[model samples]
Target: MSEAASIAEMPPRYDPNGVEERWYLKWEQDGRFKPDLESEAEPFVITIPPPNVTGELHLGHALTYGIEDILGRYTRMRGFNTLILPGTDHAGIATQNVVEKQLAKEGVSRYDLGREAFVERAWLWKEKYAENIRQQFRALGCAFDWSRERFTMDPQYVDAVLEFFIRLFEEGKIYRGWRVINWCPRCQSAISDIEVDDREREDSLYYLRYPLKDGSGDIVVATVRPETILGDVAVAVNPRDDRFRDLVGKTAILPLLGRELSIVADEMVDTEFGTGAVKITPAHDFADFEVAERHHLDMPIAIGPDARITEVGGPYEGQTVSEARVSVLRDLGAGGYL
Candidate 1:
């Protein structure tokens, strides 16, 4: 007997064409995927987490859908009215990226097409991919209610979201507020905490001189962003650090800007970072923001959304951070402040 033609004459491949194809199609045609609304059985509802329209099924999605399908089948066999709602996410960022890449290939940009046209392109992209995701779910044999399929931007869904928002606002459940956040200069947007990728990188620690207002002596404060010193509200030192105990009550003249910076003592200041004295730019640094709030210091906007110096920068106003840094450092060195 040859290895290729063994006595046990079963086919190597299990062809799904004549078997799964017929039954799955019949199930869909007979409306088995949807629950019998008039049935007396107990209702079982599951709204599966929608996948991004710009994405495809990966190992994770396959595994999750498989388990959910098993549970759904078991519940159906137990005579429950199963209603597994299916949907695809609008995935704002992901969809934006897809369209942006398409535009890139055509040597264009979102700005070139303008807001209205760009939005049109986005919708077209969504329409093309949304169906593909549905087909993927169907191929995975997910017994979901396609009749009740949802897209977040659907007119009815939008209305529901608006109603919820209006109700929340009327109940004083939501309000505008300010706090520290992770910002993406390239994307020109504020991102959620989960979106931030924390990694280690090397950068220079700057030591700059802040002369005391009394013309007595200069105090050196360390910072990473020299351009933000234009908005410096205070010089912070660890309250328990003996090195800066006497300097705490004093006032320091901001080097190039000539604005007076209060020498504040706060336990939040890291004793080991830089020179045991850190410049407090509340608008730029999270720890400094908290320190300013506790000590009643002013929080002025220094860096703009475009990453340019704000009006607070005086001579460096309207310059990009990198551009302003070079000029600021040159001026500081020339003025014996660096």
Candidate 2:
């Protein structure tokens, strides 16, 4: 018989669509994906990339498992022993977000549920989703060693991560504090720079006044956010600005918010931007953050993580930041202080 005819007569080498479920269950129950130290055959292994726990099957997953399966199955076909390791990132932020969303639907917050309860919910969610993922991988016929599955957030795995972080800190490579972190509102966490993609577009600029402490007149200042006015801590100008040289030692009455602030000269101020003066809300903008740090100005965050005006924002408290901005501007303009 011809080779092609012989193969065709060989019952199709067992159709996966027909036997995949039964064989996969049998293989998993038999621990086919487990390591065999007794095997002396040349070992080949390939680890798959970890995807987010909430992730659905995408082109990336397809391509990744496809290539890895090719290598693993090819090596086994060549008579070498093979193992394909599979895993995923615990991805704290993404997992936490999923839990938080569930909590939100029931009108409860994570803080109310406590860490343990929230975590339990997350594990339940993880278990349900992980099974789906395993099925998807099986459907692809990837030969991964399922018994040795590693989760990045598993207790054993977390110990390694904690140990690494401790070692890195000891080596002076890692530390923590508040800074200009790119925070994700949905995730309620600070994401690394690698996670951020900036797109520059047109943004409006607002000109307003920070009146002198004596109520004489006002220092005209420019800002992109009129809403940040409630958070203003200082009005800054170049130290050498001829028009405001005498105003260096003075104070400015913060409009609407009534937060008294100083008129200070900072070298970082650009002489060419908006009346050569800027209103500094240390809690809001990056430049103001640096200016506050250098000037030892009190920097209290006036906007909460929810991006609402915080309690320290006085009358604007509890309002969405954008709404607070409009209200503050109208109040200021109505009072003839705009």
Q: Which is the leading candidate under lDDT?
A: 1
| Model 2: residues with Cα > 4 Å off, grouped in runs | 1-49, 64-85, 96-121, 138-145, 180-204, 212-218, 236-251, 257-276, 294-296, 305-308, 318-323
C-alpha TM-score for every candidate: 0.83, 0.65
Q: Tell me how candidate 1 scores on lDDT.
A: 0.87
Give the residue spans of candidate 1 off by over 4 A.
1-11, 35-44, 67-81, 182-188, 193-199
lDDT of 1 by residue, 228-316 (tens): 89889999999899999999889999988889899999988889988899998998888888998999999888888888999999988
Q: Give one digit per residue, the lDDT tens place, for model 2 in 1-338.
A: 89988877777455767788788778778866655678888888887887667756678889978988898878877867788888876667667777788888999998898888988888887877777787788887777888788887789888988999999999999999557667776567787675678888898777787779886778898877888877788889999889899888799888776788988899989999988988888877888889988998888788888878888888889999779878987887887766
Query: How much lDDT does each candidate structure score?
Result: 0.87, 0.82
